[model samples]
Target: MAANDFYKTPSDAVTAVNSIYFLLNAGSNAVQTPYNTLFNTGMNFMGDDENPGPGATNPDVRSQSVLGHASTGLRVLQIWQQHYSGIKKANIAIEKIPGIDFGANTKLRERLIGEAKFLRALYYFNLVRLYGGVPLILKDLSTLEEAHSKPRRNTVQEVYAQIEKDLIEASTVLDPIAGGADAGRATAGAAKALLAKVYLTQRKWENAILKANEVITGPYGYNLVQNYAEVFLPIYKNGPEHIFSAQFKSVSQGQGNNQAPRSVLTGVPGIVGSYADQVVFYSVPDATKPGGVDKFFSVYKLYSKKDKRRDVTFVTKFKSPTNGNWYGRLNDPAIPGDSVPFFNKYWDPANVSNLAESGANVPIIRFSEVLLILAEAENELNGPTGIAYTNINKVRRRAGLDDLTEGLSQHQFRDSLYLERRLEFVFEYQRWFDLIRERDAAGNGILESSLHKVGKTNASAKHYLFPIPQQEIDLNPNLEQNPGWL
Candidate 1:
């Protein structure tokens, strides 16, 4: 097993493993994570909703961008160093899991090992997916000698191969569903769900469909929540549909990190009472889409009015200010009042208990997405026409959109599904990868052969795979830069 202090003891291994969850946060304008540079950060710079923090010019933000570009800046090195530090810790826990005593309980040992492997795979997958083929170091390479001696990029196939393998192993060990206190932990369904996604990205449509279907139809203890908006309530932590969500606790100053309370950071800027320099931990008001009720209203189709999820998923302007919640547009004059959008989804008027305190969990992998993957892969396997409507309708039904009553050709169905995907799962960090897979080697889809002209779609350029941080390259000459940049 990995010989490291953090790798010693089952408890120590668990603590180290838990730390990896912190890496899952999406929207934090705090100085620590240069939110502006990351596409996932909803607001880039303006701290205002419309404008995220200024781009990479913000040192932390800039460094994050440079990690992909050819720039040999220290910020790039810092991000790389820190990321590996977390990766290394998680890797060590995975390695040591088997060696530790998980007691006579066979399931306990298997579950812990599975948990560690899932975390290890998740951390490495994030790195590999972000920065093409990285040094696939599976152990703690602590010293200068070890760091400098680490090998160059492993093939991208090999990187994904490892991810696929870990997830498969995790599926074997993780509990199917333990419930409540254990819901947030890795589950057999989570591994299967992630494996299906990886397979889809790899274009192994058959496997993706099979795995996704297994999760969708199998006994994983998940189902569609009755009310979509109520689904976001911390009170609904036990919702059957959520396969796995990053858990947070309600402290006076909320405990835990991640997208669970990210809305607070993005939606609620520092108020007169709150300090500007405040590291608003859990929740924030949306500067761009200000009111909890107003933004929810925006989701309504001007004409297609029957969508039940509209009220279920978001609190629209039509809904009256309940006991505590009120609806109003973002009042920011910088962006015209008409243009300013409020975020209605994922807020609790009951949260007036405290703006910062929250217990909301972020759905990292919900069964709904698994259902979508299953439908997508099944349709793709059948050339989109044979069973296309069946696959598309499941997600559409959930989103309050009408199903395609008549069968459409393969190409049309593909576009229909893609649009549904975008609407059903906005701001969930799935779009970028989804587009990447649908596109060709050139980073565009076959029928529509061009990446969406968005921020970082440099498929031709290796910027798609961020650089192996300048410092790491400098230290280990074996490391090679992706094609486009230095």
Candidate 2:
């Protein structure tokens, strides 16, 4: 079954596009996929909101947490490998699908190509952000000679230009909404929403506002779920609020969400779990302190007690099913009790006996984020207008908080929006990106400053872009390493 022969039929075109989604969502195993624990640990461990928990003793994981990961680090290599793998698959589909004649069903052919382009844009988006100037491989390589002649890294601007082009085309061809079995696939709304995020990242305020506004007022009908907690629950998977997500299912060997086990505390008498690899608070028992430990700046502490998002985002206590007794509390003396809060956002209650089998879709873009994007871009372009206030208030109100203080300066408004994004999207893997993108008064990215405030002194300007994997450089002399890595 050659690819050219296999792609001649409509069913084959569908299968070809499906493979791209499969690779993006569920790889060969749980550890290899982007949305799983391993990928998150590699990509986001340096964020102020996350730290390597007691059980995270692997040096590769620790190196990232401390912002000292080298070019040879395993996690860095895996991130590079996984994203390029996805990009290659997308390239194949994008090239082959258009050639297949769908007869009367031209829409299907158009949709498949749209999906491939959207996914390719997303893969390159991740690459360009993390590694900077990755090779813009848009076509499928056919020969061993072509594969051996590795392409040189394109400029970051070039990569972004390609991303914008693909997404613009995708948004036009994709359906406004995906329904029935087509759920979880990319839609026009997702493309527009992601493009808006890219624009916001690039500081193109006007374009960001225009694209985000389209998703908000467009025919997509996306909105925030009534209850904040329901957004991550399996029952609400692909709900109206979710513009796009990496799909997962329970008890499906490699398809389950691995974050459930990675974030859950191990040795719980009643619940099956694993080492809490990433935690909001990293602390230990100290008999000298009142709470038996010196309390540091936990990301959870940033949320006011009145904010509903706090309880939904973290679990301070859990009842043991073994004895029907609650065994955890905030500031509890017992270690692993409630002294440290576990991420509750992705914990699947259905997989109480096997956390690894939990079914939870990892949200890539949600309606709430779009609202915040609108607020941020609007403030940047036009100061805090009524539209900006209204959009930011929508998210704040959902968190059960009052409207933002009136008549704040642009600086004050931007600061507030930054905090709002952090609290709104903890453990969803947005913190690191936000930290790197948002700048401080000094004109430097807040990533280094924010990490330093949290006692991560190793963070520096060089950390803004990760080193290209040494393995990659070894294989291809054309692939140059990022600055400061040498």
Candidate 3:
């Protein structure tokens, strides 16, 4: 622990662990900084799917996204620092809680430790996936001397091993779910689901399948909500589909943040009657907006007319009161040719708060993802078996799509599974990581053909791993940069 007297009782231990979840949503400065939104902005823009929205004031974010590479950019640096800050908090709780004995029943103490370990693993998981192997700091630096002794980066494999160990231990000690005030805390099911994803990222198909099955069959009471659109509604948050989400409250800007800037329709500068504040978070757009600077690619063109998810996923049509005309993201008589679509997934019409402060929980993992994992892992193990087909069909049926073709080869199933994930998780900050993990058959480059298809020609072998932030390198002379950045 950072201080020996920091955690003396079980309540103190629980409070410290709870603080980690708060850091995930609200930043150190609270109102001005929403850590999760900023982190997702960096991830979403870096990918090929989203573009910088019109009138975007953040030059650092815009340059990093459109140019496809910026080692020392502001958002990149902030993301690195925020993640490490989270890791530091998690480390403190993990190190201190286990040693303190709480009278008779040790279950409370042990569960708190499990929660800390789960959060620590999650912080490390994000670090490994983004910057590859980062410094694996598991304990708190209690003094300035300990902190000044800079640590070197560990191997990617070593980081994964640590993450795996933490999650495995967490699953055993944590409860399946929490109620009342502790509703959003980590659960045994969350640990299993995350561990399953870790295995999937490592391409350990059998292990991924095993962990996913435990999550699916476990008595956590998770299920796919009937309506795809309703699943993201603030009322339905942490409901049936939710395995894990970063909880937010709409009381104040300092208290909570949302995905509005990246998902809303923004344009029309300085208009008094503008509906901007009603729909979006900030006046300045961060990523994509409908009918403005950077807009979404036409996923509507790819989706069937019968597909329900298309409407839920992206905004295609809306009424524009400014011009007293109707507008459509793709093609409509009232809108101009340049207008493109924006994400509608995070829209909360009921949220009439100032600056569109939303209470909507940001989903990290859902039951649908578990089903997809089961399908993908099963198909990889054996070419489109009955189990794989059945699970994939469940997702498709909800989206108003037909069942997948029955006789796909192993390679074909892999491609189909990737496409499914793309459509399912659009605008949720999953695309970049998905592309990073995907490898070509020749193993020459990551997302080579996929990036090219999306006109992300700036993407190259060097992009397989993000450069270790320059600020971190400067602070710690021992830290080495990722290969291409060197």
lDDT of 2: 0.84
The local distance difference test score of each candidate is 0.56, 0.84, 0.74
- lDDT string for model 1 (315-351, tens) is 3232232343333344345334432222333444455
Clashing pairs in 2: none
Residue pairs clashing in model 3 are 54-293
Query: What are the runs in model 3 whose C-alpha is more than 4 Å off?
Result: 27-35, 267-297, 317-339, 353-355, 441-446
Model 2, residue 361: distance off in Å is: 0.8
RMSD (Cα, Å) for all candidates, in order, is 7.2, 2.8, 5.5
The C-alpha stretches of model 1 lying farther than 4 A from their native spots are: 1-9, 25-39, 42-83, 143-145, 252-339, 385-388, 440-463
Give the TM-score comparing model 3 with the true structure, all chains together.
Answer: 0.88
Candidate number of the best TM-score: 2
lDDT: which is higher, 2 or 3? 2
Predicted structure 2, TM vs. truth: 0.94
- Once all C-alphas are superposed, what RMSD does model 1 give against the true structure? 7.2
lDDT score, candidate 2, position 114: 97
Worst 10 residues of 1 by lDDT: 271-280
